[model samples]
Target: MTLQEIFALSPIMLAFGVHAQLSKTTQNSTSNVKEEDVEVIRIVESRIQRLSSGATGLGLDSYETPQSVSIVEDDTIANYQLDDINSLFEHVTGINIDRTETDRTYFNSRGFDITSMHVDGSGVPFGDIFVGDMDTAIYERVEFIRGSNGLITGLGNPSGTVNYVRKRPENDFAARVDLTYGRWAKMRAVADVSTPLTESGTWAARAVVVHQDKESWLNLYGNNRNVVYGVVDGQISDTVTVTVGYSFHDNNAEGNTWGAVPQIYSDGTQADFPASTTTAMNWTYWDTLNRNAFAEVSWFINDDLNFTSKLNHINYEEQSELFYTYWNTGLDRQTGLGLLGYPGKFSAKDDTLIWDNTLQGNFNTWGREHTFIVGVSLADAQTSDLDSAAMSGFDVMPAFAGWTGNEVSRPEWAAPTEAGFADIKLNRYYTAMQLSVSDRLDLVLGGSFIDYDNEGEAWGASTSTTEDGTSPYLGFTWEAIDNVNFYASYSDIYQPQYYLNEDIEPLGSAYGRSYEAGVKSRFENNFLISLALFRTEQENLYEFLGYDDGDGVDDEDYSDDFTYALYQGITVASNGFEVEVSGPLNDEWSLIGGLTVLNMRGENGSEARTHIPRRTFKLLADYAPQWNEKLNAGVSVRWQSEVYSETTGFGRITQDSYGLVGGYASYTFNQQLSLHVNVDNILDETYLGSVRSEQTFAGSPTDYSVTLRWDF
Candidate 1:
């Protein structure tokens, strides 16, 4: 019912529905849409619409792009009410999300999970363990450019790239505020505001702030976070535009409680860790702080030329560790005894500087079409930290409710803080340029060259320096059917060098290549759909393990000394197909969905390195019914196929896969205010988002959150 209709009835009746159940109700009915598939018109933001006066292939020569690409539009964000990195990412095809205690965010795309993030064509830094540590408030649209960016961003994985575009100042002032409450005591508040700084509308400023806290399915694990972001844009003249932005975020966690402990008992029978065992080991909680700033400018040289440049800086500091990792101290797998696992105090800091510049040109020949783009990129980052630890030879384990920041006294260990920390520093740079040609006939040709270098030093037994090279990209796109676009692209990627291990041996550099094909289409601005097939090969892979340096010292010394180094550049490859559909099917209803299937394997089970995964899948869907202009309700579901990775010592480990479902209904009584509630993980699906065999740590559990939002 419309808000007005419900209001006219009885306030008591509306109150009763407000307290109704928030559960997912499946729809088994088949789609009534015509059998003949129709292309979905894209309702994407202006930045990604690819405007062109002629039949010239959209602004950028995507047909000639060396790698794969995906775009998440503004409509997607507004419809899903995405106010964070995870929600924005969930809508992108091939992307996966795993929330660890609500403190950290982990994701996997293609086949690699520990991805390097980038924003506005610049590389963004990640936490020590390779988790994204950036605020999403400063972003308006997200562009995913797959493949090697040797010609664009310089250094990145061949799997793909994620580029976040900060929200730009419009010609007028605008703002949005949202409040939400969901199951599990979840409460969230967010505000985004922008306005012109001058009557001429040449200067503009915008800001976004968010604060949220919630519990998890796990016993003692949960999350709390606060983020602030601001940006300013100035038009120097009719031909010039400049932009500056910054963001600060703090992620405070209750526990790092890695995944569940292995299923084992005193007699070897699979037994659960007591449904109440939430805290993994003794980790109480940890906190991390991150900040970033950047400046960008664009110049319109002439009728057919434009130049753009951006410089970015990022910093991160970790105060405490969520949990102390415990591994099998003995190589013998039979004991199953966890060694040295508990909560450890730690501190770390990281700083990064990245820059990117691009030039775009438009020209005409023989009444045909030609668009060109040339760009270069570079980045440097370093991180290090120290920590203290204490272990009880054999102590009684504690339950989730009983776990706290209090430390345990050990008779054998005094001033356990004596366990120092590892100090590390690293630096790297990448440069690339590309030129493309396109014909109105739906054909494009392009070529690019890339150069990269890496050098770094680390204390605590390791220091090294290295460099590498890469050159490979071929692509093609053809309109097979009336509105169907078929595309194929190949690219080669490379990375800078880093330390090998505790010995400081240099692993030199790493490189790889990718092959992909897909077909995509846009509907009448309501939604979009696409399908892709891909495969990738990586060389010069890095390997880590416990090595006996032939010294009388025990494995403890070796484990501490052994780090990682390049062996022979193991040949690792992955192939898969992905399908994505998003947009409203009708006036009253809208939907979004995707699916992925991966097949990746190593050659001859090479010990040097192992293939990422044999097969995996990711799916997402959302349906919202307008139910009259003043009232709306909808549900969203995201799912990922199981994951499997092999270990040099352990044969194969399987990561269970699962799905997460959420629903929301909102009512706006007036133009200035509204109330809404959402239910996440409606089914409470159980699954692991990540796993570290060596550390014996898994991701957090499935839970729900209830939120209340408001705007003026």
Candidate 2:
């Protein structure tokens, strides 16, 4: 379908009540509802489950929460065949992924980078530098909050926050197995089992194992991955519960590239390369391993009060031997003779520990019910890196006319040396209170106090710093009618910088503030629609002026050997609006759609981060016809506006507007067996996956997958 048709379908579907077979399923009493209709509704509701207390600590639903929230459940993951975090983020609203390299990816939202991520409401470290691709088999659902979350995370950026909820052991005994095969010589298998350990069903254990091997569209690239996860839940007494879990993930990839393909040639003209072109050699590789352990305890004091404690630990390691190609003298259009290669070997290790405690309760005051929450958290992390390089000559590459990946041979490496080291500690105390001022209005107040410290060295430079600060949050919600709510919120956060100034000193810290207002409505048949407007301001951001040559003067001759960077602080602001609609259109159709528009500028009235798209739209829908109870089908569409990046010699690198189409179908043979088929890029559209002044990468072509599942 075309973009115009997709945009117009939203209102038409809601107004006309298309496919009116399941309209009576929403009634409080199922007296007139059919047995099959009731079952369909139940399954739909479970697939699109809602979260309680995802934005604030007062346990408010999406309609009552003052911030915008979105969730992706297990059913959606399986239907789309999303195996890693990179693929999952593509379906989330207002999110963009930057595929800078084959093995590393960066995420951004609202014209800023996302720096905060949590598991079960507890903060953890996240970034391309800390870990590689994360597997999604251990998570039941992922929640997103589209604004500054100061009350939950003490120090962070204003882009957004992500929370991953884990899958737990069930009270019953069940098992499932799946085998999948896809294009590009890809194969996968998964096994999951859950059972009760006692006759009383008070204790339970669950385990999951996964293995996958796949080849990429790029030349000479492939990967092998494995995952193992296990969890146990026990009831110590009628009022107490305990849970523990562990997970391990390993990924090994060959022929990994360090950067993207060059975008410009020597004559300041654009260069065109095939989608299958790559700069990696046959001997290059990147491997990573991640391990996580967590434990939790809960106590139910009464119906209105409760307490919980959690502990989490993580260990991550990575090793890579790669080659980076650069065009210092620019590539010749006829011969491609100016390319040079730099080979390096590197390893990294990261360790983290976190502890959190929370207490919450409700009370009666002034003829109204009020709720309060208090929590404390402590986190410590350490990271170290080692590096090595070839001692002899391995700098020139053969001509690109008839070049193959096997042309270059492995180089001799030198002794490894310490590249960087860091130790970070954070302690935070937070509190929140929700007051029901009247039958039509509510108020929320919260804040966090944080103490942060870091000590380490990076590339022969000291990175030690210390800071302490407080972040504040406030919000209000008013019920305008029977099923409508109007809300507004304000919050702020702080982040310490690692960049150095001309005098060789740290740049202190940066601060950010967010303001938002929105309206939400719940229509008949459980349909939800929301419209939101937001503004964010960030100050003290570092900007580069020039490279210093130790003589207090800017010089191009020492560009490769500069001692320090001349930096200054600047302020930036971003304004945006979003509209989202999700729910079942009728008994047979379910839909999720969103549109986002953004504009960002610096203090000088110039556009900032021009490489990010200014507008994006996403739509997904599923159909389960009553005529065929055992068959289902779905479709997905995504579109984005133009983006451009500027460079000194290449003028501008631009990527025009583009759209993608995908679809899936499934058939159930019996109660214990099923088959599914998925097709991606059905339209066979060609586009750039990433566009930057330095380099660019091509997106994937049409692909297909088939899966067989069994349940017992």
Candidate 3:
């Protein structure tokens, strides 16, 4: 059917009874009351089943057989008012979000970081903010599999996996548009449209675009993001389905306001300033880009037999331009500080391409039940960095001109003319599999092998690195009873830290391992509760205190030649327990909250980072009074616990780790339009969503926004 034909059949428009009203006035001789057909108003929400092609008992699960797994459905996505990819992560049962660096959000599961991300169970080349890329609008749901997805993810950190389930086309026409404006000129607009091209619903297509920009609450910094995406799905005969998709995202961040915590008073009191001051030093502009394209084909050999193939192509780039201004703890009449290090610039770029595929399925066997999945994959990940010396110098705390809010800082020195260059490449091939004995029992076994080559000129010297090794995996899961489940798994994982050494070549390592158990209750999919216990360990931890390269001359020149200072790195082991409950409390109220307590020991418990929070809590509550259905409003609040930062015995990065709350109210005017207003950090509390922990930066406050949406 054509678009116009579909529009004519819309139930929403028929409910107005306008056509019948005109007909009655023109030709009804029955002022005496005539029999008439009554139009029924019916609304059909998007079907949960139509959201994905298949299901594995729980919601949409990772078909590749995971050590332990879970899914976050689309309905959940809409429930939380999540606007971006990072926002949706809170839905994960055991995951925690941390801001370890500026704009670099770190998500951890089972005591380790999550470095792998997928698109419909396949890799998206550039997964996180590291590449300043991600546009979550095209996917229907996301599946997170903790522990060694190496069978499908190839080489990288094996701690956990994030798979963005891309949405395909159907015969029905669906479209939604949203526009929002936030504090400091933060504005965003997004549009999505999808439909089928063939009468039989054999061919379908979808397109999406998103644009957003916002001013920094930290003073001079501001950020902007743009995305464009498209996809095509075709049914090749009745047994095979083919899908191809492409996504592009560009992110530019200026006036980096890395946060800094004060050192005075132990209770933690935030001193107010002009807001533009970087605390001590925060002056840099960093930009990044990520582009991805992928193709997938699924074939059903019989009612119970199926095979799937996937190919992903990705391109990522990063750019940086910074000016450093030193802060001397000065009082502000102007920019508040003086210049120290010379104004300099540092830039790096990464290019990666991954080729992977999986052959997996389930076969009837055993008196009980059995399911198995296996796959093989490969990747070519490369990086290059270009740097420069001091170019200009200005007052670190210049005379004020209305603090732009962007942090400005200078570098202490520059790389020797020929040194500061890096070019490296790593190639890897991995094979893995998972087998489950029962609906509630699963076992995971996998392996990975990597070979890498790197060559670069950094610090006025040439260097090269060659390395190869294998990582193994093992895991098991069992449901203890009706409302409780327990799972324990282990996997040895690694990553290439590749970077320019004194010689300038890629040299890196990897780390990850976990023993986990969890209990989940899902009497109603809308109301989910879970508690997880995990023991995590990390290895290959490499930290360089920096060794002097022999460059002739005296002690000063003695620092020329890079000598050697290497210890396999510190090993950290952590035991933690987490509890969470989210979803509807009733028809008018819903909640999302969780808490985690961890006991971490690094370098065999010799020392603790003073500032890292050992315990953290996150809570969100939403209430919507029906008010007769047509009109409804919702209010939501969010909060977190005290967090820690490093201490130098002089000053510290303090994140008292307090609570933050935000509220949002939305109203539906009709079937096609809605308006929403949100005040994030309604208390306007001065706090950090995350911390980087240094004299350089910390995080800033809550902001507000309003959004309007139209759907058909």
Q: Which candidate leads in lDDT?
A: 2
TM-scores vs. true structure, each candidate: 0.77, 0.89, 0.76
Candidate 1 lDDT, 198-279, residue by residue in tens = 7656577888888988665455666788988887765555455567777888877764554334433333232233334444
Model 2 Cα lDDT, one tens digit per residue, 1-712: 4222432453321111000111112223333556645433322222233233477755566788888887777778888887788878877778877776788776778877777788777765334222456778778878888887787777646778888877776657888898999998989998889897876565778899999999988888888899999987655554456677888999998888887677777777766778777888888899999888777766645546667777677788999988777655677888888777767789999888777777877789999878888988888778998988656325677776345777667888899899778888878899989889999799988988888888877666677888898889999999889789899999885876666666666677779888889998988886788898999999986665554544655343333333455567779899899898777888998877688899999989999877788998877788999999899899988888998877667567777899989978999999999999999889888777676446756778898999999989
Clashes of 3: 46
Task: State the TM-score for model 1.
Answer: 0.77
In what order do the candidates fall by TM-score, top score first? 2, 1, 3
Model 2: runs farther than 4 Å from truth? 1-53, 125-131, 500-504, 542-569
Candidates 2 and 3, the one with greater lDDT: 2
Candidate 1 residue 97 Cα shift, in angstroms, is: 5.0
What shift in Å separates residue 117 of candidate 1 from its native position after superposition? Answer: 0.9
Write candidate 3's Cα lDDT for 411-454 as tens digits.
45556233343444444454433455777776655666666555
Worst 10 residues of 1 by lDDT: 17-26
Model 3 TM-score is 0.76
Q: Each prediction's Cα RMSD?
A: 12.9, 10.2, 11.5
